[model samples]
Target: MSELPMTVRVDGLPDRVTIYEVGPRDGLQNEKTVVPVEVKAEFVRRLVAAGLPVVEATSFVHPRWVPQLADAAELMTALGEEGRHLPVLVPNERGLDRALELGLEHVAIFGSATETFATKNLNRTFDEQFAMFEPTVARAREAGMDVRAYVSMCFGDPWEGAVPVDQVVTAGTRLLDLGAGQLSLGDTIGVATAGHVRALVAAFGDAGVGTDRLAMHFHDTYGQALANTFSALQAGITTFDASAGGLGGCPYAKSATGNLATEDLVWMLDGLGIEHGVDLGAVVATSTWMAGHLGRPSPSAVVRALAG
Candidate 1:
C-alpha cells in the first residue's frame, strides 16, 4: 500500500499557510438534516483539537434562509468561549446583532461577483448588494470585529456565463474598501482552471490587493480545486478555505458540488512540504466520525484512502 507522501520543498510557495476550516459553517450549511447543535459544537472542538487554527462556527443568517443553522444562537450559547474567537457568517445588520448579542468578535459577509447571483442568492442587484453589506460591516468594525468578505462566483456564474476578471476585481475591491480585513475569492461553481486562477490573482495584484489580503475558496464540482489551489500557491496566496471531508456546496447555485476537502488539501500540502498546521490523521478521523452522523461516506479522496 502507498503510504503518506514524503515532504518535498516547492519554490515560491510560502513556508507555512493558513488552512481556514469552513466545515461547521459552510460544510454543514446545506445539510438536508439539521445536525444537532451539540454535534456541531463537537465538530468545532474536534477541528480545533486537530490544530485547525480557524474553524468557522456557524452562520447567523435567518433560519428561514438556511434552516440547517437555525440553532445558531443555541450553538453559540453551547460553545461559549470556544465560539467567540471563531468567525460566524452575518448576512446583515440583524445577523450581526445576533452575533454581537452572543459576544462573537469575528464575522464574515457573503457577496456575489455577478449580478444574476446577487439577485438570485441575496435578493438584491449586484450594485445594490454592497449597500446592504455596508451597514453590517461598519457596525461590526465599529464593535472592533474582524470582517471577511467572500466574493462568490469569481470564475464563472451559472446564470451569467464567464464573470469578467475586471468585474470580480471591482467587486472585491469594493468589499475590501468596506472595511473587510480580507477577501476570499470563491469559485462557486468549481469551473476555474489554473490559468484562470493566475489571471484573477494577477488582476487583484495589479489592483494593489496583495495576496496576503486574499483567500481562495473552491469547490470540487469540476475536480479543478486542487489545481486551482496550486495556482494560487504559485501566485503567493497563503490562506485557503476548505471544508472537512469535502462537505457542503452552494445551495443557491444548484450546480456546485462539495468544497475542496480539508484532508485532500492537507495531503497535497504535506506532499509539497507546506506547513499548514493541521493533523491529517485527526481530521480524517473527525470526518469519519462526522460522516456517521450524516449517514454517508466522506467525499474526500484522502479521507476514503486514509480511513480505509
Candidate 2:
C-alpha cells in the first residue's frame, strides 16, 4: 500500500467526502441467489448504524431484467422511515411510479456514456435513454423528490473500449440539466486508471460542471480503484460511492467485479485525516457478516489484512 503523503497541502483537500454505501442495492443485486428480505434490511441497517449518509437501498427495475432485485418494493417498504437518504434505482416511468408509490423521497436514474453500453444496458440508444428520462426527471422534481443520475462506463466500456472524454462530459451535462441533483460517474468495469480519472474530472470541470455535483463510483477490477479515487480527490471531487465487502458487479459487463471496498476507503481516509464520519471497524464487521452469509471471502484487501 502507498503511504499517505506527509507534507501534502491541506488547502486542496475537500472539506469532507460523502460515501454513498451501495451494498444493499448494487451489491446484492448481482448475487446469484436471492438474499432474504430480512438479510437485505439487516445489511442496510448496519450501514446506517455505521453512519452512512446516503445508502442506495434497491432498484425498482423489472424482475425479468434483474431477478436479484425482484423484491425492490418489498425492500423499500421494509426499510420504512429511515432518516438517512435511501435512493432506489428507477429505470423508467414504471420504475419511477413504483418508487413514488412507496413514498420514496430520493430516486436514481441511469444512462451510459457509450452508445453500445446504452443500447445493451437500457435496450435503447443514448438519445432514447435521455429522452425517456426527461418526463421522469421532471415528475420527480415536481414531486419534491431528490434525483440522482448515474452515467455508467464513464471511464471505459467492456464492449466498446476507451470512451472519449468529450462524450462523458456531454452525458454528464445533459443529466445535470435534466434536474439530476447529483451525477455519479461510474467506472463500471473497473478499467479506470489514475490518468483516466484525472482527465475525466478535468473534462467535467472544463464543461462548467462543479465538482460538488459529481461523485465517483469505481469498481476495483484491476486493484486501481483507490489510486483512481485519490486522483479524483485531487481533481476537487468530494462524494464517492462504495460497497461493503466490495460487493457489486456490472450485470451488463460480465468481466467487471465488485466496487471499491468501504473499509479500504475509510482506512485510506483515516491515514489522510479526512473526515468521513464512518466507522471502519463497524464497516469491517458488516462486511464480514455479509461475506459469511454469501459464503465468500471479502474483496477488500484491507478487511482481509485487518481480520488476520
Candidate 3:
C-alpha cells in the first residue's frame, strides 16, 4: 500500500472534501440479492475504518420498494454505538419515524427534478412528492437531526431529455427551504457532461444555494462521473456521494449504471493532491471484499488497475 501524494493547491477546489459514503444504503439497495444484515453492518464498519467521515447506513423505505434493504432496522441495530455520522434515507415521515426510533440523528430525503421521474419513481406529481418530504424534513429538523435532500435526475431523465437547469435549481431550492441543510444534485441517468455540471452548480449558486450546501452524486454509465466530479470541485462543491466498488445504480432509470466508485474518486483526488481523508488501499480492499460478497468483479477502474 503506497501513500497518497502530498496535497496540492488547486485553485477554487476545497482543501478538504467530505465524501458521504452511500455504499451500504444506496449501493446495496439496488442489488438483486438481499444482503444479510450482518454483511451490511460489516460493510459499513469497514468503510468507517477506512476513514469515511460520513456513511449512509441504510434506507427506511418499505421492504416492498427495496427488498434488498428490508432489514434496515436490524442492520442499524447491528451497527450499534459506532459513533459515526450515519445518515439513512427517509422517503417520508414514516421512514423518518422508524429511523428516529433507533436514535438516528441524520437523514436524507429524496425528490426528482423532472416530472416524469418524479411520477415514475415516487408515483406522485412534482408538487405531491415535495409535499410528501416537506413534513418529513420538517419533523426531522424539529427533532434536531441533520437532513440532506437529494435532487435526482437533475441533468437528464430517461423519458425527458436534457432537464432544464432552472428545474433543478427549483427543486434544490425547495428542499433547502424545507429545512434540508445539504442538497445533492444527482445525475441519475449518467447523462451530464462537464459543461452541464458547471452550469447547474452556478445556477444553484445564483439562486442563493451556496456551494457549501451542495454535493454531487454522479453515475459512471458513460464514464463521466470523475469528469463531472472535477467540474463540481472547480465549482466549489466540497461534498460528494460515492459507493464502494461502484456498487449501485438507479433501478428506476433503465439506462443508469453503477455510481462513481469511492476508490476511483480517491485516486483522482490523490493525484491532484486534494485532501480527502480516505485511504486508497483500504477502500480498494473494502470494495474488493464487497465485490466478492456480491459475486462479481468491482466496477471501479482504479480498483482493477491498483490490483494489477
Candidate 4:
C-alpha cells in the first residue's frame, strides 16, 4: 500500500491562521458522562501550554441543559492565570450573568441559521432565539466582555436540509450588527462540503462582512471538516475553531460527531508553513491525555500516528 500523505502544499496559502481551541467547552460538553472538574482544568492548562492562543474554557449554560458542564464556574476559576484567551459559551442573559460573576472577560453566544435546527437545538424559533441574544449580547458588552457569535448549521441543517446561502449571510450580518466581535460559522452536523464552504464565504462577503471578522467551525462527521477548512482558508478566512482530541458532539443533532481536532489542524498548518504559534507535539500529547481519561481512542489522526 502507498504511504499516506501527511500534508500538502497548497499554493497561495495564508501566512497565518488563528486557532480558537474549543476542546474544554465544545469537546467535553457532549460526553455521555460528566468529566471531573480538575481533569477539565488540566486539559485547559495543557492546551494553553501547547501555545493555543484562544482556548474555550467552559460554558455557563444551566446544568439542566448540559450536565457535562455543570462545573463551568469551577473550571473557569481553576484555569489559573492562563496562557491563552479563555472564552466561555453564554447561552443567554442568565449564562452571561454567571460568566460575569466568574470575572470572565470573553464569552460566546450561539444562534442557528435554520429555523428547524434552532427550534430543535435551542427550543425556540430563529427570530425568538435571535431576540433572546440581543439583551445577552448587550449585557456582555456592557460588562466589558468580548463577545463572539456562533451561527450554527450555516452550510446545511440536518433537519432543514440544505440551508440557503442568503439565510446564512443574513444571520451572520445580524449577529455582527448586534455587537458580535467575531462571527463563527458552524457546520454543526458536519454535512458541509468544500463547495458549500466557498459559497458561504462568498455570500458573507457579498453581505459586506469582512473575512477577518469571521471564523470557521467544522465538525468531522462526513470527514469533510479539514477539506472544508481549506476552502475557508482559500476564501480569506484566517480564524478557525477546533477541539483537541476531536472531542464534542452536537447534543441536539444525534448524527453529529466532534469538532475538527487541534492536532490535525496544527499538523496541517505546520506542513503548509502557516504561522499558528502552536506546539503540535504538545497538542497531540494533550489530545492523547484527554482521550485516555475519556477511555476512548482519539479521533485525531495526527495524534494516533504521531503517538505511535
Candidate 5:
C-alpha cells in the first residue's frame, strides 16, 4: 500500500488529499443507460488500478428507485475477492441488509439537509429519515464495518433555495450520532460558491465536527465544483468525492448537473503540487472509455480538452 502524505500545512492545506472515487455508484446511478454488471465491475477494477484508494462500488437501493444499479448483487459478487476499500451505498435497513449479506466492510448512507429535499428524494421527513437509518448504521458498525453518511443539499436546495449552515450541521450531527464515522457534505444542486464552501466548512468546525471526519461532494451545475473544492482545501478538508467523466446528477433536483469530474479535480490537485496518489493520465483514459460505453462525449472539460 502506498503511504499518503499526512502533513497539515500552516495555511490549512493538507500535504495529501484523499479522493473518494464515486463514479461507479453515485456517477452511474443517474445515467439513463443500463451499464452491464461486468462493465461496472471492470470500471471499479480500473479505478483501483489507477490508484484511487477509496472507490464507491455500488448502491444497494431498491431497483424501483435506481434501475441502472439494479445489478448491485451481481457486481459485488464479481469483485468480492478483490482487496480494496470499496464502499457501497445503503439507503435503509433493506439496503443495508443486502450490503451486509454481501459482506461489505464499508458503506455509505444518503440523506438531505433540507426538509423539502429530504421528503422529495427520500420520501421521508427529517426525523423519519434519521429514525430509518439509525438502526442500519448502528448494525453496520456493530458488524465491524465503517459507515459514511452523506448529507445532500448542504448549500442550496432547488425547492428550499438557501439551506442554513446550522441546519446542515444539525443533520450532519444526527448522522454522526447514528454511528456514521464520517459525514460527506454534498452540494447536490451545485449552487455552492467558494465563499459558501468556506463558510459551511467553518460552521461545521464550530459545531465541533472536525474536518478529519468530513468530506466534500460537489456538483458542477453552475461550474463551481472546482472553485468550491479549492475553498474546502483551505478549510482543511482533505477528502473529496469525484465522478469519472462527471457522470451523475440528482434526478429529483432538476437544476443539478454532473458531479465534480475526477479528471478536473486531478488537474487542480496536480497544479497545486498536492499528493493524492492518483495517476492523472490513467484516470483520463478510464473516463474516456466510459464515455464510449455511454455513447456520449464526457461532460468533463479536462477529459475533452485532454482527449482532443
Candidate 6:
C-alpha cells in the first residue's frame, strides 16, 4: 500500500495553503523540562529544511511564565542570520523590544477572547488586555515588522464553558484594527465541532474580517481538530497553524492537548490535493528526530505510522 493519499480535488478550497509551523515556540512552551537552546535551534532548522514555509521560532515571554523557552535569546543566536526571518511571539512592548534588538522582522501577540481566560492567562481584565496589546502592535508596525495576533480560546474556555461566536469576532477584529496583519483563531480547549468552526468563521466574515486575514489554530483535545480544519477549508480558509509531531498546547489551560500535528495535516492536505508546499517524508523524519530528544512517542498518528 502506498503512504500517499489519492488526490481528489475538492472545490471551494484554495489551490495553495500556508502551513504556519509552531513547533519550536508553541510546541515546546509546555514541556516540563527546559529544552536546550541548541536542540531548539536545530528543530527549527530541520523543519525549515523540510519545506515548512513559516516556522515561529520562540517566544520572548517572561522566563518565569514559560521556563521551557527561557533561552529565547540564545535560541535566536543559535539560528543566526535565519532568525531574522522567522516569527517570534512577544507578549508586550518589552517583549517586542527584545525581538527588535535581535533584528527580527516578524512577531506575534497572544490575546484572549473570553474574560476568564484574559484574567487567568494575561492577569488582566478583558478590556485591559487590549490596552496591553495596543502599544506592542503599534510599535511592531512602526518598526516595519509584520504583526500576527492570536485570539486564543475562540471556541471554548475551560472556566467559562462555550464561548460566543460574536465575542470572538469582536476580539479578533479589534486586534486586526490594532494593526495585526493576520489573526489566528485558536480553539484552545478543542471543544469545537465542525459546525462551530464554520459558524465562527462566518461570524468573522459578517463582522468584516475577511478569510484572508484569518488562520485556524486547533488543538486535538477532543480529537476534533482535523474535522474542524476541514470545516475551515470548506469555508475558504487557507492558513493553518500546526505543530510537528503533535507538539504544543496551552500552558495555562490544563484541558488543552497537543496541537494539530503537521504530519497529519500534511497527510490530509496531500490527500485533498491542496498545495501546502510541505514534504511529508521530511516532516516525519524531523518530528521523529525531535521525538527522540523529547523521550516520548509522538502523538501524531501519521508520525507513529511513518516513523515506526
Cα lDDT tens digits, model 4, 1-308, are: 21233455778779999999999888888898678999998888888888999998888888987899998888777775562248989999989888887777899999999899889878889888878899999988998889999999887787788889999988889889999999999999899999888988888888888899999999999899889988888999999999998889888888889899988887778767778999887888888888888898898888789876
Better of 3 and 4 by TM-score: 3
- List all candidate RMSDs to the true structure: 0.8, 2.4, 1.6, 2.2, 3.8, 0.7
lDDT tens readout by residue for model 1, 131-161: 9999999999999999999999999999898
Scored by lDDT, model 6 comes in at 0.93
Q: Write the per-residue lDDT of candidate 2 for residues 1-308, one digit (tens) a residue.
A: 33222333355777679999989889988888688888898999999999888889999988998898998888878878872258988999999999888888999999999999989989989888889999999999998999999999998888889899999999999989999999999999999999889989888888989898999999999999999988888898999999988998988799899999988888877767678899877888899988888988898987898765
lDDT of 5: 0.89
Residues 1-308, candidate 6, lDDT per residue (tens digit)?
A: 58898999888888889999999999999988677888899999999998999999999999999999889998998899999999999999899999999999999999999999999889998889999999999999999999999999998999989898899998998899999999999999889899999999999889888899999999999999999999999999999999999998989999899999999999999989999889899999999988888889899999999888
Cα lDDT of all candidates, in order?
Answer: 0.95, 0.88, 0.89, 0.87, 0.89, 0.93
Residues forming the 10-long window of minimal summed lDDT in candidate 1: 1-10
Leading candidate by lDDT:
1
Between 3 and 6, whose lDDT is larger? 6
Clashing residue pairs in candidate 5 are: none
Question: TM-score of each candidate?
Answer: 0.99, 0.95, 0.96, 0.95, 0.95, 0.99
List candidate 1 segments past 4 Å from native: none
